[model samples]
Target: MTASYDAISPARQAISSARRVVVKIGSSALTSLERGIHSASLDSLADAVEARMRAGSDVVVVSSGAIGAGLAPLGLTRRPKDLATKQAAASVGQLALAHAWGTSFARYGRTVGQVLLSADDFARREHHRNAQRTLERLRSLGAVAVVNENDTVATEEIRFGDNDRLAALVAHLVGADALLLLSDVDGLYDGDPRKGDANLIPEVRSRADLEGVIAGTGGVLGTGGMASKLSAARLAADAGVPVLLAAASAADEALGSGRVGTAFAARPVRLSARKFWVRHAADARGSLRLDAGAVRAVARRSSLLAAGITSIHGRFYGGDVVSLVGPDDDVVARGVVEYDSTELTGMLGRSTHELPDDLRRPVVHADDLVVV
Candidate 1:
């Protein structure tokens, strides 16, 4: 007879057995226009997280609601369009948001630590490590790290835009085994959930599973929609972390039972730490268009040489991350540029033997390059 243990899929088992998890709650799930931050929803979330903690699992929460919570209190009926007004609202709402989270978690004898982050935190290696250390320290002290975008100071270009992607990045940074995205929608669907014919998708094994699905944006009070959630799911999945997407109302069931949402199975292959940082963490400062030969060489894991560079786009200096673009304009890889754009302009299409001793090095060293 065949040995029998549990019939649960590995993805489902991952959810139930996750030791450290990242739970991301969206604006719509945590707040309302009329009442501002919803205490009941937060309380329920705290209950679930505390239960996990009691079971010796560590939990991190990436929450969105600062602007939404600030809207009603600041006399704004709708989300502000102007950057200044949005920032002002976030400044006011973040305090209330943090207070609500702290109070809710306190009910279960748990403490919460608020962490505000910007895109720069993840884009820069030193900053990323610092943020990771802070979060790890907080968890070591048995406190839930409640994270949000530093919206009051973040510019449009540097903003995370939504917490979904931030949560996925955090999952990777902290080495989380699972990520739970709690939103207003229960799960991904074959079509728009607003339509009656749509059916909830219980599992997503790969990107191919979402071929015909239509994901819509969030409501008036939120920034992300189902599309962002799916993107976040795929991001975490690529990092070998399983993800569960479910409605906030089903927090307990989704986290504990692992039976109420769409579970995305993680990719089997694991990326190197350096490659993961290069692919997911570093921000590209510029792009280098490569010749056909250069593209072929890069595909074979070779260093990028000035002789293969056809053109460069944008201005960047040495030590900055840059995209390696193919002749067809697709980004084939990314790496830390070894030469400034202006310096590279003088050296392009010239072989290393023809260059001065100091300029003979690869444009991007093989150790720094990561295939996309």
Candidate 2:
């Protein structure tokens, strides 16, 4: 079904039955200028989470607001524009943010564990696997995992763009059944909410639901806007995780399944964690340029043969992530290369029959590839 906004979608039903969930709170929802962090919001959130946990659902919180919380302590009136300043703010704010969350949850007898992550942590397979173990262990120990991006150490190029995307990836990492994105806005509006004449959309079954729907910019203190939240929702849905986009004030109702926000249905099938990592997290070490026939072949889910490659760029080892570029220089796909750049250099444009037995294998197997 299309995103009619009122349908009883499978994803909405999935939200009510989700045994494990990831709730992402935006910076605007958690902090303000008068108070670095909102204590009442934290208390309300803890209550909702506690209720969910009591109902057999374990919760992971991916939150933003470190920079916002730090603004008060650093005497900054607004978010800093410089990288060093933002990092400095994050270092200070993260500690304060964690402390507030711990204290807030502690009142309800809940133990909160802070997990700070960088893009590198999710990009590297070993680190990603380790992170999974850590979060699982935390849940097993009966602690709530509160995660945030490692903003202090992140540079412009390495940043996750916004916590919205980070939260979506975290949902995939923890095998979450549902993802709830909390923002200042109540739900996605058909028109600009600020300008009126808008209607709240209640459901999205696919990316087509977002067509002609323009999203607004973020708040003064937050980095992610409605656009980013929509992107996060789409990402999580693509990974077979349903999503709920709602306002932070309606946390209790949203958690209680009051049908007050937009629900995005998950796909029938999704990429495995390892494949998700390769597609969304891995940093490509090199690119393999393919000819027209090879592009068409790869599009048909065929394994990439060495005869398809015209040339290579950059240094990469076996099992490393590589981009499959078309003749037009567009990246057609990404995959785990079977051979090193050096090993593949000599086999370019040569058929499997013409190559040595050791090099006769497909350059990249279909299982390791994902079409973009």
Candidate 3:
């Protein structure tokens, strides 16, 4: 069925049956000023999470606000522009964010565990697998995993653009059944919520319907606007995880009332975690320009053959990440190179059947490739 805000019953049903869920709370929802945490919001969130736990669902919270919480006490009015300052704020704010969750959850006799992630952690296979295992262990131990980006050490290039994307990836990594994206806005609006004509977009079954509903840069907290949330929704949905976008204040009601927010329906079949990482998270170090036939083959989910490669650029070692560029020179996917740059050049355009037995294998296996 075509998903739309008006027809969110399917997504609602998913939420109702979801056993494991990942909730992403934006910085605006978690803190009021740079100096202190939002106690009311924190308490309300803990209550919602506790209720979910009571229902026997495993809950993980991916939160943002370390920098926001750290800002005011440091005497800053707005988010700092410099990377060092931002990192400093995050270091301080992270403690406060965790403390708030711990203190609030404690009242309900729940334990909270802190998980800090960086972009690299999700990119590499080993680290990603380890993270998933650790989170699973934490849940089994009856502790709520409260995750946030490792902002203190993150440079500009390594930083997650926003927590929304990080949360979406986390959902995939942990095999979450649903993702809840909490923000200041109640739900997605057709126009800017500040504008009277803006109407709430209740469901989004297709990306085409989201053409003009991009969020404005008007939210009270956090740099990510509606566009980022939409990206997050799309990410989660594509991974076979449904998503709910709603107001943080309404979190409890949304989780309990069974009738609020914008729900993005998920695809029926889910991609494997490794493939998701290859398709959505891995950074490419070089580009492999391919012939038209190679493009078609890759599009059909075939392994990239060395014979189809026409050109290569940038230096990459064996196992280094690279992009598969189509005939039109657009990146179609990413994969790890089986051969180094120099070796690939010698093997390029040589059909696998004609190559020596030692070189006959596919350059990149389908299992290791991710289409963009």
Query: For this target, which candidate reaches the highest TM-score against the unseen true structure?
Result: 2
- What TM-score against the true fold does each predicted structure earn? 0.94, 0.96, 0.94
Judged by whole-model lDDT over C-alpha atoms, candidate 2 comes out at 0.89
Per-residue lDDT for 70-169 in model 3, tens only? 9887888888788899889888899988998999999988899999999988877788888999999999999999999999987778877899999999
Q: Rank the candidates by lDDT, best first.
A: 2, 1, 3
After aligning candidate 1 to the native by TM-score, how far in Å is the CA of 236 from where it should be?
1.1
Candidate 2 or 1, higher TM-score: 2
Candidate 1 lDDT at 157 equals: 91
The segments of candidate 2 whose C-alpha lies over 4 angstroms from its true place after superposition are 1-7
Worst 10 residues of 1 by lDDT: 1-10
**Model 1 residue 61 CA deviation in Å:** 0.6
lDDT of each: 0.89, 0.89, 0.84
Steric clash count of candidate 1: 0
Deviation from native of the Cα of residue 19 in model 2, angstroms: 0.2
Comparing candidate 2 with candidate 3, which one achieves the higher TM-score? 2
